[model samples]
Target: MEDNGNSTACCVKLADALMSMACMDLQLQSSIHLCASDNRLVPGKPLSPGSTIISDDGTFALGFFSPSNPKKHYYVGIWYNNIPKFTVVWVANRAAPITVPSSAVFTLTRSSNLTLSDGNGHVLWTTMAKSRISISSPRNTKNISTEAMLDNTGNLILRSLADNAIIWQSFDHPTDTLLPGMNLRLSHNTHPLQRLISWKDIRDPSPGPFSYGADPNNLLQRFIWHGSVPHRRSPVWNNYLLIGKYMNNLNSTIYMAINHDSDEVYMSFGMPTGPFSVLIRMKITYLGKSNISAWTTLYSEPVHDCNIYGYCGPNSYCDNTDAVPACKCLDGFEPREEERRTNNRSFLLGCRRRKALRCHHGNSFLTYPSMKVPDNFIYIHKRSFDECMVECRSNCSCVAYAYSNISSGIIDDTRCLLWTGELIDMEKGTMDGDKEIAVKRLGKGSAQGVVEFKNEMLQEIQRLTGQQGSR
Candidate 1:
């Protein structure tokens, strides 16, 4: 046990050398594989709860986060990393959340799939819906190396290193917000129509009743639907470069682009570029309204509830130009239930025909200019003014018709739209729209009908257009 000074120094050097060699061996082992996060994971290396991967630009981060009721469920999601608020944009286990957070692990499996599993190996969620990688047989394992990246634009991509191909992307499947570069496809050859559905509530990310997308039957127009019912419709696209542009509350320009080809027809939004930093998103709100919101302020498409579908009921039109938004009856119509009329003369019971129509008698058409056309229209192409008039005149069921000479890009340029059945969700004084509708009504003295006016405004409007001629 006794040692000289020189011998003791030599022993210390030997110990130091061994320690250095072990540290070098550890560093080499770490360099063998690449990880998505700083504490990256390779095959068999999983991310337990509370771990995360941040984007290179630090704009977004992917991690496991819980909602308001943390004990109920936990989700693997992506959110804005730089913002003060935790705004989640993408969710991995949206439909099936992990009920037990402490027992969950998010991992890239040996089969090159991103999966979430419990401690007992119960698979909770996975990106295996369209995986192209091959699974290993009994003796051999697949060595396909994959990496997860959160791109600067907030896209989470699982990429294969072998051939540099993306296995899956978060942009393809959106929950609520429609980012700038994401495409909202109206029609696709192989896939169903793509849309953005709102969340169930502020505390829950479940799919809500509100949805925003293109009209499936007519791809030219976009619509916001409330549980399969059309709520609000966008103006038909003019086939121009910019479909619509608005200066958001944050003083940034947000514009939408329309693409139409033989394969697909889609729309995508764009934010202001160059020097300015801003993010804009189009979202369907839980209350069934489509809103384009920025970081600072939110702007709604249909500003008033009267603009919503069927708010004013059938045969009546919502008038938003007035100081107080109100509904008005068409010429020669009265309130369906006159007893429900208030002292201020507001018609809560919609409208009904003042004079009942006889199919055998001759009827006249009344023209109303600058109006938002009603819903449930039948489109007929290649029709002139006289032909459109005859088309409606020939059928006793045709109640109204509107004509528009759309630009060439649409399916039919010379468009004639006719409406039958109940005329629900109409609007008057729509300055942005430039179409006129001709409605059929019985001629004066043709039936035992009495005209009743609830208010002076409606009575004055009836007097001004009562003499309108019909062909």
Candidate 2:
């Protein structure tokens, strides 16, 4: 009887200890679940359809989202948490959406990858293939982990927990919106550039026709393209730093800046950091329009039809200074008679030169001040004003040339642009000041005329300098 009682007592103690351990394990798991709810995802913790990971500041949220129209296909995306409307900034599975939203799971694997898998164990999207995460672990033991977090600036970052190094981020893969602090790379020596591609339509988040990025041929300017054709073009970057500034109603200054390094040149915009600072974002819509949003359209591209690229056609310029912007031919050109007669003022047929050039005879250049230099120019480096003129004059194929001293704090260089063929996409009174000048070659076959014109240009330069000094 004593042995039996001792055995029973031992069994009871063992059961009680096991129960205590079970409760402690449950509590630990409960704490982990709570921690996962707040802005982060660790290994083995997956985000479901209804659940979301909000940013630390509650400014943005990352979760599954379905566009309003179909309401059937769901995608993992990041959107504004503070705003009333659901404005998605980035999408993870843009091309592949989940049909069964409830069965979709977004997980951060131990390999430091963010993956979205469906009910049947099919991966709709993953960061594993795109990024290579190097996690150090003990010999024969795989215990390394990673986490994904939504940042306050609307960036979704995947980082390794072992060393806390960022493996991948959503800012580098923008869909259609350009949030503050995000950059549009103008030039890079190695890394592939990113483009903001508009969604297919209002209801679909797939790729669209309109896309915006830096011009591959020229890094000095950016282009918004409709398929392969340029829809709109931004003004060339003359200065290496601050491009423009805007003053909001709250008296905060928003600045657009271009930054350059040894290997890269990128453009970004930022506002003052304070309580008065409002949420500002630039989005390219599906309808091929770019808008800066701050509860209102602060800035929009293609403000008028004249703002479109090559709107007035080749050999002509859009004159925006008038009450109604009009297309006008260059100084030594005239609109084609047939097209002008078809639509009296449209000038869609472009223009033709008034006379033909004689290469053997010397020519004089007609200078147009305060003009936006034409497109399709050949850039010549490290050339003086006289040298640029001689370069153009010597080349019989060169039709025109423009030279400017583009000496800024970051770059001390000159812009010597030579045009061999017909000039395209010129604008008048567009530059802020007398910054851009376009010189067109005229068929004046006199050597004395060329020398006299050069002297006149020198005198004009001195006069402009004197006026600037007075300022």
Candidate 3:
């Protein structure tokens, strides 16, 4: 009976020991769960739903999100953590959204790549497994460890723990929003350009119909495209470093600069560097509008619908000086269909020259200051004003010529643009008023010098005004 009692005591001791171990295991799991919510993501650790990896500064968060409530689709995206409005800046699985949000897992793999998997262990999205560093030995490559980190700049980066070299970064592959410090590549001699593609809709993170990027054909300008067609065009870069400047609520100046290098050209914006710096972003809307928004709307390009590319058609310009911007024919041109203009129809018919060009007979150039130069220009390098005029005069097909002194140290000192055939996509009195100089072809006797040209144009304008007053 004593031996049986001892066995029972042993059984109770074993049960108590098992309970302590179970409690310790649960505590370890709870600690690991807390660590998973921090900025760094190590290999073997997976981030599931309801858990987010925030940036070190707590400015951005990376996690699974469903755009709408009754959640049918969910995507892994990075967004502002501090802001009340959840604004996603970058999306990882844009093309493939997970139907089961609860079953989704985002993990950094042993191979130094980030992988997103669905419930059934099917891979949804993965970072390209590209070696950023050269491995001297094959064995060393296998031993290299990696971790994924979310940065204060809203960039998700995967880096090697061995050398801390970046294997892949989300900033290199942008979505709709362009965060400050992210380069929008304008021109590259060899590399393919990157574009900011809009979301399919408010509820869908898939690529939409609208895209914003540099014009492939023209390196000096940018375009907002609707599929294959240009929806709007930015003013040609005048080789100025500062393209845009604005002020925030804090009275800090936000500067957008276009930087040039020997091999590439890119546009990037920056806000004041401080602890109280506000978030600034440029985003392309699903409907094809480009907006620069802070807490409130700061600026939007092509402010009016009439500012759309080719809206005024050929041989015309969009006049934005008035309260409501409207299309107007160039000085020497008139509407092709007067009836259409009067009936409030579209200007797709464009404009026609009031008189046909008679080459070199009595041709003179009419200066239109503060204008946006039309598209499809033939750029002539290093030409003086007189030389530019002579070159245009020599060509019978040349319709108009514009000359400007860039002197911005990166580009050519002088810009001599010659236009032939029809002129398209011109604007007047916009933000780039100082950069453009539109000179039109008119009647007989070209001016010999800049002073002479301005004088003659002034007298001609006064004469026209006098004639109108008398009538």
Best by lDDT: 3
Q: Judge candidate 3 at residue 387 and give its lDDT.
A: 82
lDDT of 2 at 304: 80
Worst 10 residues of 1 by lDDT: 1-10
Candidate 1 local lDDT, 1-471, one digit each (tens): 111111001111112211222111101101112123542344565677645676665555677666644246677887655443457777778777777777888887767778898778899888884665654531232554666667767787778777889888778888888876777778889978888988887666778888999888886567888888888876544333332334543345566666676788778886656222324567787777777754444568677777777777788888877997888888988777662456533455678887776664366677766577777789888986557766876788988887654443635756677888778777887533434677888864332221121132234334433422220
> What would the TM-scores of all predictions be?
0.74, 0.81, 0.82
Q: Which residue runs does candidate 1 get wrong by more than 4 Å?
A: 1-45, 69-71, 134-145, 233-252, 272-278, 338-349, 356-365, 384-386, 408-410, 429-434, 441-471
- Deviation of model 1 at 293, angstroms: 1.0
lDDT of each: 0.64, 0.68, 0.71
All candidates in order of lDDT, best leading: 3, 2, 1
Q: Report the candidate with higher lDDT, 2 versus 3.
A: 3
Q: Candidate 2 — what's its lDDT?
A: 0.68
Q: Clash number for every model?
A: 0, 0, 1
Q: Per-residue CA lDDT of candidate 3, range 42-67, in tens? A: 76668887577878755677877767
